[model samples]
Target: MALVFRPDKKSIEKTLAALKSYGNLVAPDARFNYDAKDGLRKEVCFRDEDFLSLLSSIDDEYVVDSILEMLKGKALVPPDAFYSKDAFDKLVALTKEKWYYPWTSFTKAMRRLFYMLASIKQPRIVVGMGIFYGYTLAWSAGPSCGKDKLYNAERVYGVDINTEAIEGARKNFAILEGSDHVELIAEDGRLVAQRLEGPVVFLHLDADGEKIGKKLYLELLKILYPKLAKGAWVLAHDVTDPGFQKQGVFTEYLNYVRDPKYFSESILFDIDQCGLELSIK
Candidate 1:
């Protein structure tokens, strides 16, 4: 019966105790806070907005990791302050693919994707190839496993082809609990590489077409190769969607499938029988 996004630990504890009085808190922290004023000086506060603002200050790479822990239902515990890269990756993947609950499942997918990227060595940047309303909304939810972790990403960017989608993404982040961790760009996803100035920890090509997705992926590799961290994570969503197959998007873009340079890795999920993960290792 815990509330949502409790910023400060002390306040969160008090809130949790109070929420237990209610019928298994589903969203008590929906709007809770803790503030103290001394003379003419006001100190810290613990509101959902404040919690989100705190998340905004986080580094992009770590943000995903932090949120993964939070959604796992671990961040609520008193902190012993531990950070393990391997532990993080395993935990993230487990939480996402293993956790229950419809909303929590979405958060887990995002966490799995984000943690995979964050774990890459010395990544300098991360990008969301395209932002759509449903996708962004799905990405914004917290972790489904650990609770102690908080967001800590370094540099992040979100790109999109639709202006309205971009705007919706912006508004979504504006109201979400921890949106300050990302940057949103309402532009064509194909040009993300040209626009970015650093190595990529992760890249997601979620545009609605195979041609554009392929072009963007190749362009990103060409422009950002030097900056690409070894073993970095790259994600392509809806790669096997009916529309893509119907239009032969994958066949058109992958006409000459490259060898060893890239390989496919699949992620199995119980939610969707068609769910398959594609990656190069």
Candidate 2:
């Protein structure tokens, strides 16, 4: 990730030290405008070439267009990549409700991408970390209609640390049509990951992005690595958010996935700061 901060030697040194603690190497890059006080601010690039390449590869023109159409023109055209009618219908229905938390609702473009990928992957088990009102859980569950169902996944498991949020999600699930396939658990994500036994075909990470977030994410990865099925798809939220980027969350995450052992193909959907990684194990 690219970072531009005020040209303070002490601040730069502190930032570099923090980044190195997360297994990142700092490299000097071209300066850019950061604020009015600083005419031109210094820039630094994290040495995560593989992760950056993966982010570039998955950013498609069609995805960008779809995001613009949804947010700008308020158009709801499903991307051509999403061919499942049932999945599309579910996405539309979920968006109509105001059940999700204001901060946690999935954007239309992100939902569309998830529907498309889930339809294609047809994972046997769908796992969601940090469930907030179950909006993403519904999407990961895929279409519930027997005739319209195209995925092989039988159930979706949602884990969240907040008991109140878990209760809210359960209430939302109760009112949702064809939501019988969802299971909500109020527990730490790390424990949930440890208990999960079967192959995970689809995984979504949407938890916090600081110390707790980094710990839970990495711990879950260690547990899930052996359990991931071939063609498993993983989506991580907020990788490009300004707050996360400032906190070095994105850099630490990129370093983890950049290892050759984890994923075969990975991409960062620039829209809504969603990052996706694919594994063929």
lDDT tens digits, residue span 1-281, model 2: 99976457677666666665654243343232345254332442432444444444464436644543553342222334344755576556655664655465455556666766666556678898887777776666655423466654577888888888899888877766566778899988888888788788788887653467644665677788778776577777666654556568657666666666677656565654344443333
lDDT of 1 at 55: 41
Model 1 agreement with the true structure over 1-281: per-residue lDDT tens digits: 98776257777777676765653222544433335442232433332334333443443345545544553463322244333455555454543454322231123334444443343322345676655642432232222112423444566677777777777666655543344556777766546667676656565555553455444555554565555565554555544443444455555334322334553332322112112233443
* Window of ten residues with lowest summed lDDT in model 2: 71-80
- Candidate 1's clash total is 28
Instruction: State how far residue 180 of model 1 sits from its true place (Å).
Output: 2.3
lDDT of 1 at 133: 46
TM-score each candidate: 0.47, 0.67
User: For model 2, how big is the CA root-mean-square deviation?
Assistant: 9.1
**TM-score winner:** 2
Runs in model 1 lying further than 4 Å from the true structure: 1-124, 137-151, 209-222, 252-258, 262-276
